[model samples]
Target: MEKWAFITGASGGIGSAISLMLAQKGYHLYLHYRKGHEEIEKIKVRCEQYGIHVVLIQADLTDLDELQNIGRTISRMPDVLVNNAGLTHYGLFTETRIEDVEQLYQINIRAPFLLAQMFTPSMVRRQFGRIINISSIWGMTGASCEVLYSMTKGALLSFTKALAKELAPSQVTVNAVVPGAIEGKLLQRQFSSEELGLITDEIPMGRLGKPEEVASLVWYLIQEDAAYITGQVISPNGGWYT
Candidate 1:
């Protein structure tokens, strides 16, 4: 039997890692991206070398109508759905505008909820499925300057817990991955060299985690070995937040 997985933000760092890792596991991938066809094109080529099928799904996740279009292009219902698309705003709560807050929620929290509504029915009918949401440490412990991002991610964590219970009876499992100080553009863009050093030093591992490490966890959850695990907010934070 073949397994299909749909992943949003597939052109980006973490999403690409997850897509490639799943391809190596022999899962057909539907890689979703919001912008720039070129990035996913590279990833698609990489996945194909593993001899697995990879499809590209493009959607402006903030647009509800566009998000609905994602599943229509792909013929099969995915056995796995990874909601990895999100936006974050870092600043004083008072300095942030109302619109940015709304946008953050739309991408981080709303899109996942909408995608679940679209995909979960077939999953329940099939009696097997896996859903993994890429969450952050800020979601678990609120960040001082990133108040808006924290709120939406916190809601995602709550959403994972509640939905896991509802879907588990049908053999569908939902989980979230909480990552910390991941080596990515976001960290580079957000912090200075000295700041990054301070952050890395604080981590017990003394380094940033590779996106592949995060991808591996998502791979593990879909296996029969992890069937007993659901509704859990598992962190791959290198003991940073434990």
Candidate 2:
């Protein structure tokens, strides 16, 4: 049987890149998106060229019940689960709204935990699974005006490490990819070219990491060669956090 991967935030950016990469590697995909049906359809069309089965599931990760329902609806448990759906809130902590904080936590922390819980049993039974949580550089090193987002990601990092140990004996690997500033709609909206250049210059590599770069690392971590590696937070941040 073809291995299957479940990728949240599969509509664009890093998530979309990872989906395409995995499809080329011959993995069937279950893509989860919040509100980008048009974009998802485009990805589905592209994925068909690779001759991989593409399934689209639209559910806001903030709603844990909906996520569980989606999980149950899928025909088979995924061989790999990429928890890439997350929301970011920027502003002084004092100015951030409680509702926004809650929403961020819901998507970043709660949803991943619940989805993992729902799907992991089947993986354990099969003795084969890969869980990759797409975290952030801020999650490792806290960022100003991004306190809540950092907290949730930090929690995810901790979850990755702890769960990796728990599932290792079952041949399941859990890890996180901590990415630096990538060229994407989200980063462009937050920083001007000048500001982005300054940020990039601060990195040892003097360049923003690309989404495809991160996806490549994820691709490696899910392979059979990576079986011995688990419970690790691997940062591909262009030497930004060293």
Candidate 3:
């Protein structure tokens, strides 16, 4: 039998890395993105070279209707679901708008919860599944300006723990990958050299993590040997927060 992995944000930093790694592992990919079709199409073409089916779907996760319509667009249900599409907000709490909070929750939390419903039933019937939510270090430690982002990721962490227990009996494993300071263009835009240096100084490893490193952990959790591991909030943060 063949396997399928549906990864939201597959055109992005960590998502694209995960997509490539899973495609290399021989799983057909459903690369989900809201925009960035040009970037996502490149992934589809590259994954196809690995001889696995690669399909692309465009859906704005913040919109519930579009999210619900995702199931109808896919060829079949996915064995692995990577809930990775999210946006980050950086501003003082006092300056944060109510609308920003709602939109953040819509993408980071509610979308994944709804997607679990969309895909889990097939796994329950087949008795196997892997669900990995891409979280953040701020979720664990809570950052100053990123209050809303922290709230969203913290919610994802809790969701992973509770859902793992509910799905474990059905042989479906759920976990969250908490990443810290991964190398991305967005990071450059978010922080200046001094700020980035200060951030790096705090990390014991003295550097940011690579997207491939996070993908490696997700790859391991979905394997047969990892069947026993569930309900974990695993972080690849270079010993930043133990």
lDDT of 1 at 114: 90
For lDDT, candidate 1 versus 3, the one ahead is 3
C-alpha lDDT (0 to 100) for residue 112 of candidate 2: 87
lDDT of each: 0.92, 0.91, 0.94
lDDT of 1 at 45: 98
- Residue-wise C-alpha lDDT for candidate 2, range 1-242, written one tens digit per residue: 78999999999799999999999999999999999999999998888799999999999777767877996789988999999988888899899888998899899999889888878998999999999999998999999999999999999999999999999999999999999888798899889999998998999988888889989999999999999999899999888887
The candidate that achieves the highest lDDT relative to the unseen native structure: 3
| Model 2 regions more than 4 Å off | none
Per-residue lDDT of model 3, residues 1-242, tens digit only: 99999999999989999999999999999999988989999889888889999888999998889999999888799999999888999999999999999999999999999999999999999999999999999999999999999999999999999999999999999999999899887788899989999999999999999999999999999999999999999999999999
TM-score of each: 0.98, 0.98, 0.98
Q: Candidate 3's C-alpha lDDT?
A: 0.94
User: What would you estimate as the lDDT of candidate 1?
Assistant: 0.92
Report the poorest 10 consecutive residues by lDDT, candidate 3. 180-189
Models, CA RMSD each: 0.8, 0.9, 0.8
Predicted candidate 1 versus true structure: per-residue lDDT over 107-182, tens digit per residue: 9999999998889999999999999999999999999999999999999999999999999999999999988989
Model 1 RMSD in Å is: 0.8
lDDT order of candidates, top first? 3, 1, 2
